[model samples]
Target: MKSLVALAVGALVAGGIAFAAPASAGCQAGWTPWGGGEICDGPVGSDGNFERCQTTGVLGFGGTQCFIANVGNAQPPRVGP
Candidate 1:
């Protein structure tokens, strides 16, 4: 029984790490027009200006046993004082 408990605990820990890895869901895409016309492209901000941008993990699973890992895009933030 004790051994089983240990095994379970180990599995749980691993699983937790996997799920916690999705920690880049920032910015949700908002502004747009860097050199097109208006001129408003700057959503960089970890400690500066930021607008919106997100999407870096499981969003919309498909049918049976579906899966939707990290997609991409929306990334411009990581400043400091």
Candidate 2:
């Protein structure tokens, strides 16, 4: 029973999805802020997860918007579902 409980907890942790700054913006998906607004280049398909605001890290409230690029470089190619 203890092992089953542990397994359940592990599954729960694994099943949950982590939303990063870039991920929330849908920019890089995992890209995060190193601070000072340094130029960032990520691998293709790489996701950015920036964490600047202390409040809820979603779009509109200054969280990474999934529809806009945080940086001023060319946007990434849109991926098809």
Candidate 3:
């Protein structure tokens, strides 16, 4: 029995990945804009000057590019799981 337990433990350790589960959560949609973000009214819009977080995404002069879930709340980014 001890040998079986030891073998199982050894195999798990060797696999490395079994140590812990992957962290949940990622850049949520309409949560916040990232990269160059998106433009709502037009593509050439500027930050704050032209765009604002909306349900569809950072709206501006053209249209939205980023997902809506990534650009809504005014709260700072947080870890989600």
Instruction: Report the lDDT tens digits of candidate 3 across residue range 34-81.
Output: 212211221222342222231221222122343232223423322232
Our model 2 lands, by Cα RMSD against the true structure, at: 14.3
Candidate 1 residue lDDT tens string, 15-59: 433334223243122111211001112345455444432211111
Those runs of model 1 whose alpha carbons end farther than 4 Å from true positions after fitting are: 21-81
Worst window of 10 by summed lDDT in candidate 2 = 52-61
lDDT of each: 0.28, 0.29, 0.29
Q: Residue 57 of candidate 3: its Cα lDDT?
A: 16
Model 3, global lDDT: 0.29
Scanning candidate 1 in windows of ten residues, the lowest lDDT window is 31-40
TM-score of each: 0.25, 0.23, 0.21
RMSD of each: 17.0, 14.3, 19.3
